[model samples]
Target chain A: MASPHANPSPRASRSNRATTVHLRLRKEIVSGHYPQGSALAEPVLAEHFHTSRAPVREALIALEREGLVSFEKTGRTRVRTIEAKDIREIMEARAALESMAAGLANRNWTAADTALIARNIDAQANVQSLAELSRLDIDLHHHVMLRSGNTRLLQLWEPLRWQYEAYLVEIFKRQAKEDYRPETDTIPSHRKLLKALSSGTPAEATQVMMEHVLFNMTWAN
Target chain B: MASPHANPSPRASRSNRATTVHLRLRKEIVSGHYPQGSALAEPVLAEHFHTSRAPVREALIALEREGLVSFEKTGRTRVRTIEAKDIREIMEARAALESMAAGLANRNWTAADTALIARNIDAQANVQSLAELSRLDIDLHHHVMLRSGNTRLLQLWEPLRWQYEAYLVEIFKRQAKEDYRPETDTIPSHRKLLKALSSGTPAEATQVMMEHVLFNMTWAN
Candidate 1:
């Protein structure tokens, strides 16, 4: 007889299997397809992903480390519940990390960096909905981290991005019926930061960046 | 014939099985027992832990999330190499986050808080050896983060303690033979910080904390 948790036959190229499984499960979790506190069994996930339990198990663990899931020492596996406090904590961390990134980007930015930021700003300006605007906002922050030239900073902040994106999606979906503006005025501050970077005053840039981050945090609240 | 990656027999308890495997493997990777870039096989790890591939697989995935290992599509996992750049980025982030935590701790600290900090400082004063001193130093920082009342900050900085510990141990081992009294002298700064916290001047404490972090960052150089 086959084992209760027998491995599924492999169905995909192994090279991208992990990434594929990770993305699929991540999307399911973030999109609210999987209700909070749902059980995520390894054998079940493997069957869903058409892969062995090995990769699916790894994906869930990755999600746990990313603060997207929690685990307990039960005989079976389960998905952890997301709490408001967790969301708040993630927001606070994002504010601090992003503020630092923005400040560093301001201080170290070149003309080319300014040009890239300008393009992002323009793209964001053209976006109509809060969802589009939020995605652009993420891209803008990513641009800053990339320009800041801090690889570790980027890595430290990367895991939080998915959660942030989920939160943004949730908030935007709730406010979809309301009139939402594109936040075009925030571009002026970004421009000022660019000026500070060009002048080589990281301190001033950092202050501006702090204000920018605080502003976003308040908006989230 | 038994499959190469298949478990030959079943286990009695699977709950502690995963945690036990995870802790053992994490210890090996964290202690540098596994050489960097060394491949970690699921079957091999399962056999060594006297468990099935399921729990061992889960542990490896968790390790990957912690940056202790990297999984590739080639159906193999390896210990991640710690790069100088990675260290530097982590330090930069630590500097910013810890500085913020210190500032908040200072602002919110009551007389009781001051007493706790002072106690830790006094404990550090009695410690011998650079390693013990380093451990106390981290404990002090952890205490500060806890006192800051920012749960998010604590969670964000949690995983980083491992990297910090590893770096500290390496640096302390190297500087043990040399006269590094100046580093020890920095202890007084912690005292000064406590005084600032008692005085309710968070700005001053934040400045001092930033300097303290920057000072530690210089150690790796």
Candidate 2:
């Protein structure tokens, strides 16, 4: 899942000030910089963003809807705590969605698609840290999702990705350095998937993709 | 595809006014009452909802993030239009998730679970109108998803449901009266699914559920 509030370059140009506030606050909440259950003071946020309380209030409400933050009437808004159950549920959902995407991509993949996937895998192989590996992993999955030509799938999957990324970041920071190594032979699976796609059997491709997602689910959990 | 905004009493009390506004607008969009690409006027909505512009504006922003609404800086917000491609992608994703949910529910269900699902299906069969039937259809799916015991699956599957519901409402409204006949025989499929779940073979349940979803997709499209 990408950051709900990452606010890529394009967003700045097209979005209003309220959206900008949403993006920044979303970043903070998902990244754990705000910490779980920590109160978000509207006046303080307004001061920090150099905007009025109205937009900040709006931003908090937006974040609340995304499951990133929560607020009580006449009370403060706070970052929602990430729980194990939440992570497990997210991973399961990812397993379903990504497996489907992989299946579609596999059935549709041309030689060019295979080459692109192979390159992504190679890039993953060179990552030195869990953080870099994590980033590459997201990019690779995104590549497959995009290649599947499933816009709704992309939208559905994106928020979960953002939450999972936050969790992974925390996990990376806490785990031993030796745990960060990328699987050296991961490219074979992508290659296999590509081969299955090239065979033009969506069923076979779906099966391979399912296994791929299950593998990630195991590791992420 | 149960209403994402369905307060259901419990959620209503827990949520603030802003949350309610967000959900009401979301419900409107998902129900297709606000047509795709229709402009949302801030003052008009505020007046209609008997709320201030602040909450209404916040609600629109939240909707934008959910892919149900869109806005440009210095322009009015509009109901987001979903294309055929969007529907296709959503259907594909739904197939994947719901199939997995079926499999999971099958593996996890007790005898009581089977009984409960059977009851839900029976309830669905009792609906008298197309609109009521649609609500029951959504409920049946929701029951299956909840029984699947995957929170992520529910979360991920919901937005797709909302969007699909919007489409279904459009199709339902257009179809001739004869086309709206309730499927009295469809309960058997639910029974079969229950039997599969009771047997604790997730794979079998998954297959059945996939077929069930595909069957609906064929007619729905």
| Cα-based lDDT at residue B54, candidate 1 | 77
Highest-lDDT candidate = 2
**Model 2 Cα shift for residue A44 (angstroms):** 2.4
lDDT of 1 at B189: 74
Docking quality class, candidate 1: acceptable
Q: Write candidate 2's Cα lDDT for A56-117 as tens digits.
A: 77777666666677666546677776666678777777777877787777656788877776
Q: How does each model score on lDDT?
A: 0.71, 0.73
User: What's the distance in Å from true for residue B178, model 2?
Assistant: 2.5
Q: What DockQ number belongs to candidate 1?
A: 0.42
TM-score of 2: 0.84
Number of the top candidate by DockQ?
Answer: 1
